[model samples]
Target chain A: MNTIALLPHQQSPAVELDYTTFQTLLRARMKQAPDREFLVFPETDRRFTYREFYEISVSAVDWVGRQVEQGGTVCIIFRNTPEFLAIFFGAVALGITVVPVNPDLAVPEIRFIVENSGSHSVFFDPDMKGKLVPLEAELPEVRFSPLADVSELPKVDVPAIEAQLPHVEMTTPAAIIYTSGTTGFPKGVILSHMNFLVDGKGIAEWFQLNADTRSLCILPLFHNNGLVVSLASALHAGGAIIMIDPKASLRSFWALVERYNATFTSVMPSILAAILALGSDGRPGYLKGIISGGQYLPPSLGKRFESRFGVPIFEGFGSTEATSYSCFQAYPAERRAPGSVGRVMPISEMKVVDENDMEVPDGTEGEICIRGANVAIGYHNLPELQALRFRNGWYHCGDYGSRSREGDYYFSSRKDDLIVKGGEKIYPAEIENVLCMYPEVTECATIGIDDAILGQEICAFARLKEQTLVTESELLAFCAQSLARFKQPKRIVIINHLGDMPELPKGPTKKILYRVLRDYYERRLANSQDPEGLKWVLGSQGGG
Target chain B: MTIPELYAALSPLAEQVLRIPQFDKTLTMMSTPSWDSLRHVQLLSAIEQKFGIEISGDDAFKLTSAEKLVQYLHRQTEGKPQA
Candidate 1:
């Protein structure tokens, strides 16, 4: 039997293992279960076994070896495609750092990410022909390669760059993932291989993942949730992953699930709402569980989905700065606590603290801070932000929340999103959560609108369900019934759709675009008489 | 008929209504502020009604600037084939 060293506190009685690197993890899985299916995507009619995927990935590694020098940064500007996975891992294999850029970013945003990352080479999808034209002239040193042309890249028998590669200690920087700066310029969160390894191993151990485990990839791989929790975790756990096309909306997701018999999936609350809107009959039969992140999962929707599908919608939370999942509700409806995001993992530790970094008592709201092996080293080229967020050996997550006496963490609100209305502290998420319970409300965002009398008033931008219509007053009444008067939105703006729904950008660790929505509505409110009038104006103007 | 010409022809109120910044003459309307499929539909329909010229769907998708819109108008008025 092959000797497997044991990691500290590893409870795997069957196989004592210490997988230090992603490459080692992949190779071990291939040796142990070469014939097992490694990846499945029925929507694209693509499935690869462990042997097949390993071979291709190795070949891709060899291919990239000839193309890039050591320590070169390769920018990836493709949607969530299988090719993206191959390219990402392929670059990693060659000791090259990969910067996955969101393909849906607007021109200016795209330019900022690419330029700020200081990447000299990029691999792009052919579909983005016109989008990059504006910035192409400015990037004189940047070389662009189309994915469509990669097949035609001449195969040279170049020696493996492995020998030339430096010893990549787990603590060495692997990649710099950019946070979606909805409020300011995007920051590069410098994550090392150790950060990723700890997160993947920690989450896998916590969730009991193994070679037989399969996770459906619906979230954006550019973001940490899809990359770390879904892809990296599968790699470390010796499991299979199915890539979902970013363009394939929730409308056709269940069919794809049935085709692949997907065991697990992950998505944000908006995506969950979209799936729920598809009806219970629309749910696929093969799903074992889904880890919902990127946004808070409303208990009502979570209950509706779990009761209807018989598959638990497990709520998980983490930030890009901390890799993927820091905390999650495991299995069994009995162990699950309502409205709680669950306890921290074994490899991770958490403390709810005030602005002074002192721990708050249980049941009191405070900034939820995290300390673990999974936390990133620091942000690249951002000393100020690095010092601010990473201090005293802990990641000061800007999220405000409280912990129950039982150690269950409950999310309250973002410290930045707190509204002081007439000296009353109100969280928009609390109001938005109440509004989401209403059947007519497909999605809602709360923002503090300018009010000369009250200094600031709560205004809600709501997208109603299809063919389901309710007056603004009725929606407000629903909020009034469930929440305190101060928490109730002073005004509601009803619309057909909040966004494209799928291509919505998520924060580093899959948080919703609340800051983006707030800015958008604030701009809208600046020019309009009222929230209702802004809705009418926006609808009439045909600008989403 | 360039984007600049269109911006020049329109009053400042119309420019503000469009919500686009700077009228670059060489740019296409599709790249402009109010140029999404829905907004394009409304803008084109209004333009057609105002100018009394029908824009084919194919040509409409291809029209990136006000200059292209003017060319399409000239072609329609000059009895040229719509294609």
Candidate 2:
């Protein structure tokens, strides 16, 4: 199987940063470094040089300009392919707002993002095109283009800007990335160009990113963790980026490293652990460093990866609302300390604050409050939720953590209903909402279980609309197709029949009882594992 | 103790367990889909248990093929010739 032999020849990293507008920067880099390879997909043996990428992207920009309004929102539904980046920067060049959607999102989740954002046009890959086609009848007047059509369309000349506005300032809204909240509905986090650019600069500075930093992007582009950190960091440093399939990432990872001469990248703990588990031949090239975020990397796993690979796995703490990274463990020595998320970045001010917005002492866990240029411009159209999360000048991340005497921060848990299973956070409402889309599912509830590994796992309970027999594996597979891997439920509890239902709590104002379902699952888990009861409760279709 | 002999020995099992034919016949760890980052640990554990040989951390991280694993095991076994 010696797959490494299947990849293209490896090349040294060549950083040639050109600043200005993204289009101008890209064009200049291409002209200056015409022969240097920029992006590569090892599995497909697809490689693009700076000159080639710029030429194709310019044509894409011209094509998109004709299809979309100037400064209008252009919806994008695609995985982390070369075309995804091409289209993303293409839209940005025309001064159009880019709205990214997770191609793996369920039907309801995808519909919400499209409707709420009021996108004038959408660009979807083949995988996501079928899903959106069914919803086209529901919403008229919105233009759609398959990503396959972009390359085949007669390459258009770079169109002139009809009405030039001042360069998209640091304040200009760059993207609207949808993230789920405790309430179940996903909220569009408005991050400006400044937010991502500032964070990219901070991360690049922290890692000492230079032209010699070739990076591997195995993370999903829709998430801030992948887009802003891995891809943007490489681009900002004038380094080359290599994209790989998430499903086959581990198998192709080392070949990508040898093929690209990669020096750095960001990954989730799960991915890192998977790489480490591959034993010896799976060992990648000698990278300068690797950054882990999106979830906590257990100290044991981090130590094993560093000790074995001879390179460190530096942990970072951040959120979509915080533009990817707020704090980072910059060096290997810093990573030795268990549970530390490193000190706050220089561009940001972090505080461990009490419920009353008062700063708490060192070693005492409290709400992690961040004040920085990297903070998002609040949630779109959720004034009340935004007001609750923001206090004074700091954006209170609904996550509990503590700052050490040395200024390092350690995560405790979420203050909301977010379940970070593996590396991705699964909002119960998001899963429950998706489950309702199934024809057989009448009502559903989602919860988390304490796993020996993976920290937590998604567990779902469903009451069928009729007497339908559905297996747990079917539901799990359904979730895998509809949602991202981390958001997929690890187990499904099927309720055969719905008897006289228990009285759910009433929200003084009129709201669905999301809590009632949660409590039921929580009780089931508590009772099943109760020490007081001598009986070992094996599974017989119970929640949790 | 050499890589070729190791490949000869483990080739059948690697094929059967991984369901990937022509695996250990001429493949590295990176060649098989079942030998992914997560599955690699389980595979190594199975190998270590089957051979009753303690795989060093460096050797464990570096062994990409049955041949490599066998070479490392032979060296390890040679280092303690008395047994």
Candidate 3:
């Protein structure tokens, strides 16, 4: 185990949060401002004040207590709904770990998480009956309960349930978030209550959040960005949050922000791209800034969005391992660097280290590592992976980046995402960033393909702007102007050329799945027939 | 087009766009795992193309269930020439 320490400058009241567990925080918020609106779900037009949310959570405590014990784990599968949070808060308050699974995942994937987490019961939304009903028989040991609405939870005595709630320590595991692994099954990241509280406090402090801070949650609650950055941060600050179903909220993003007076919202880069693609004109209203992370935010895209919408995007860098974000761009727009993710937050320490875990000099690219109370307890049920990743008192982030002399961190690429061609290393972001500068390119991704001689070749996939026509050859020429000859793509695939994939293959959060693109290149473009009319501009047949 | 007629016309498109085994009245954004936000947009776009009409963003998200979609389309195509 690694010793956790606060940074030297942890002086902000937000950073010096005294509450230990989530329950304590929630109780404090309720006591401070019981009448203040805490969570608002626009899809169902549901609003819950702090007191109401606490009451519902108490109901959930009683409801889940009947099924699972204090030390057991429960899986909650629901879209961004209050029911999900209620169950989550209930389970964690009772010292039971809650595993929140994305309901959109295939049944097999869902089963893998439930079984791997060894969850005793799964409290799923009634809407997922078609999927979970069949799993009950398959996993006979696990109890499957459908919770359609918070109203369905038996109205239990709030005081009695609160009194009987187990004494949960700050170190008690709160949730096991399973990140989509690059290779086989996804690994479960065990986040304790202290991790959530510390990370949430860090975000709250970094953003300078207060009771007036209204967060419009456009991301799914299952992810750390939504959980900590949006929900937990707001809770820590006694702020209000308007939660909407991520899928259903894209078109209404501006409207919701304006209606709720949302001062802050967290989203992925793809969401920003999607909103930009909408081409609808709207004011930013009270929206102070957009928090972007979970993937690389192309500097061009970030600049374009900020210029167009007049809202600064505070792009950060972190993984599920460090809760949501460990570092973020400086607040108060004028202080931000143009292309950096920003300096490390005061709650954590971030250092770029080489393969041997030695600190690299400034302006040198190396793997990014984080150490702080915010770092997770480690992966669940995977001791070997835990040992490998969380070693030497630092959580190896597996992302390659460098810190500038000014202390600004620039994320280069994922360690695995690096493309080495002809004995020279290249980050896909290098080429993708250049491609995005083109007028018609809305979003793009670059990946390394298997090359017989060079070990890997470059392939770029681009999604064009709406109703825009740019041939692959033209894009290739455009890329040739900006990128080096060695780094230029050998092939460019217009992803939406034939309308087969109207959008790039993405995960639930809309992060572009480069592995899926690699597999597509291997199976469809390289191996078999090109039925989808993937417009591949092969620039120079062999190595670039 | 009546609701049932609209439903009949939408069944195949929903199945294709959503990639579901079948489409039923009970199928909704909540009930159907495959009918995600992206597919919802696709389904709406396909409906717009097939019926030669446009669905505004405001009305699009409200049409979650198959029943709601058929009703919404019936109103959209009513008193208008359908493609």
Candidate 4:
């Protein structure tokens, strides 16, 4: 498939920052104009110019080189702060595979990622010690250190800027980003340096970002959207960034925007919905415009927000595999086509393919597959799974969508059993495994129910052990300990396995037909088809 | 709206959005464990729908306590009981 960039033909990176490593790029930028501000922490009233940021990152690299051994992964688990920047940049500079974990998640949730990704050194913000200290047992091998001490690191003489053999190649693995896998365990996608650099430049080009652009980092630093869309794009565009914690309230979101005069930002659909719910006062001040990604932006909502706020809401589409965005709408020059994810960016070729991997016609709905320098090599430690997904040199997105003859792409639905609630991907297997862990539960399956506020709500159907009684509150409490708040089931339906019980349908392989369960819930969601036998064990949302 | 009227209005909001059994003076943002930042948005959306008024982003952050939200909503609908 021929990749088409929908950006204006005149758009290009103001400063072409192509280099072997981010260390080299940072050094080059610092030398170009050291006084230019790179990042601003508005909450703390702290700012780091190109020169200051480079000095801090280099000293961080020196500290890690001395204190931590040179063997295993160095994970950075912090919120949106300057510390996150130093730790991630320093680790990436030293060619250490960095795993950015969301600190806001529960400790057990964080521990799951820490356990899966083997790491020797873990860097975090000292302020988060209360939440992290409890996880010492889960990750005993990890050497913990706070990033505050990095303030004293500027004077330390760092090693020379020499690329170590076999460690710092364009295709060498740079980071392991974990996204919700269809199966229970989360799969880490191994991204290369080429992926970051190319995706950064591509985003800068598509967004028409320049040195004057002031971007906002509202999304959690752990997600790929935060890294590629906000940080990396600003890094290469020579623009500044406004870093704020993800917990910032809707009011604070606007305060930061007005305070920083932010121009570019990428937000999830839910955030936009909340902002628009504010009616007239929702629009942020002096924004060039904002783009929406990470989930579907309903055309009506996008159009409503745009017309009300006087700001264009361009919709883009990408996954952890594509680094950031494979499809994006060009702003200013043309208005967005409501549901379209725009055209494929340069360095990425996207095609809508059928079951046999053949390209389908323009208007035909098919699996959206992308091939690009930005696509991750494969899933880490999952060769068979990788082979299944990365077929024909195209990374199958597992997303069902179609393309236009004009080169725009339109999303339809997901092919995999994934539920996106408020932009957080929740696989049914994860919730089901947790439910089946209870002694009273015999069989359980989680499915997505359409919601008006959240994009989808999780509904769990369980067949309890004969004569075993379990309260909805008790089961919800059990789920709270294992899953994040967003992943918890919104409703639990207790299915009796007696004479009138409707056993879940099965396929040819005897695997439970998740489609049948999903359809039943989908019908129940329509306000008229709810079955009388489906006992509501959870919240009243279970019933119509 | 009196405190009783305000409490009556917030009963369904908390139950629907936070999935709490009931609302009281105890269910402030800092008190209720589930009334975190994310849930706050849903609560505000529900309040807006129930009151037939818009909650500004600034007001959403300030209306942390049900008491404060009631005061604000009470003032907005002070003149007309129909509101």
If scored against the real structure, what TM-score would every candidate get?
0.66, 0.73, 0.79, 0.82
lDDT of 1 by residue, A136-254 (tens): 77787887766643344445332443344445455556677876342345678777666787788877887778777788886667777778888888878888888765334343466
Candidate 1 segments exceeding 4 Å error: A1-17, A149-166, A418-544, B1-83
The best-first sequence of candidates by lDDT reads 3, 4, 2, 1
Residue A438, candidate 3: C-alpha displacement in angstroms? 40
lDDT per residue for candidate 3 within A1-544, as digits (tens), equals 1233432222121334488888889988999999999998876778999999999998988888889999999999998888899999888889999998877665666888999999979999887887677788899989998888899888988888888988887778999998745443578999988889989988999999999999998787887788998999999999999988876776667777777899999987767765665565658999999998776666777787788889999989888898879999999888999889988988888899998999999999999998887888888988888788888878898999999999999998776776655333466777877788899999988888765324467888899987787899899988765454556787898887644667778999998887888887787677533322111111111111
What TM-score does structure 3 among the candidates reach? Answer: 0.79
Q: Arrange candidates by TM-score, highest first: which order?
A: 4, 3, 2, 1
* Model 2 spans > 4 angstroms off: A1-21, A24-34, A153-166, A332-336, A434-445, A451-455, A461-488, A494-544, B1-83
Winning model by lDDT = 3
Best by DockQ: 3
DockQ of every predicted complex: 0.03, 0.04, 0.25, 0.13
Over the stretch A1-544, how does candidate 2's per-residue lDDT look in tens digits? 1211111110111112235346655666677677787887664467888877887787777677679866788788776677778888778777677888876565656777888887878888755555677677766777878875345644655444313423555455778888777777878888766567667767877887766678888777887877778776676676788776554455356666665677887788867655654443535575777888877677887888878767777888888888898898756454445678887887677889988889999999999988776788778889998888765777888889999998889998788667776566778987776677887877677777655345566778777756588876777767655564457776677765324343333478855455665676666654453331101111111111
TM-score comparison, 3 vs 4, better candidate:
4
lDDT of 4 by residue, A173-265 (tens): 678998888787678988877678778888888878988889998787888888888888888788888876554455457766777789988
TM-score of chain B of 2: 0.68
Scored by CA lDDT, what does every candidate get?
0.65, 0.68, 0.80, 0.73
Residue B6's lDDT within candidate 1 is 42
Which segments of model 3 are wrong by more than 4 Å?
Answer: A1-15, A417-544, B31-33, B48-56, B74-83
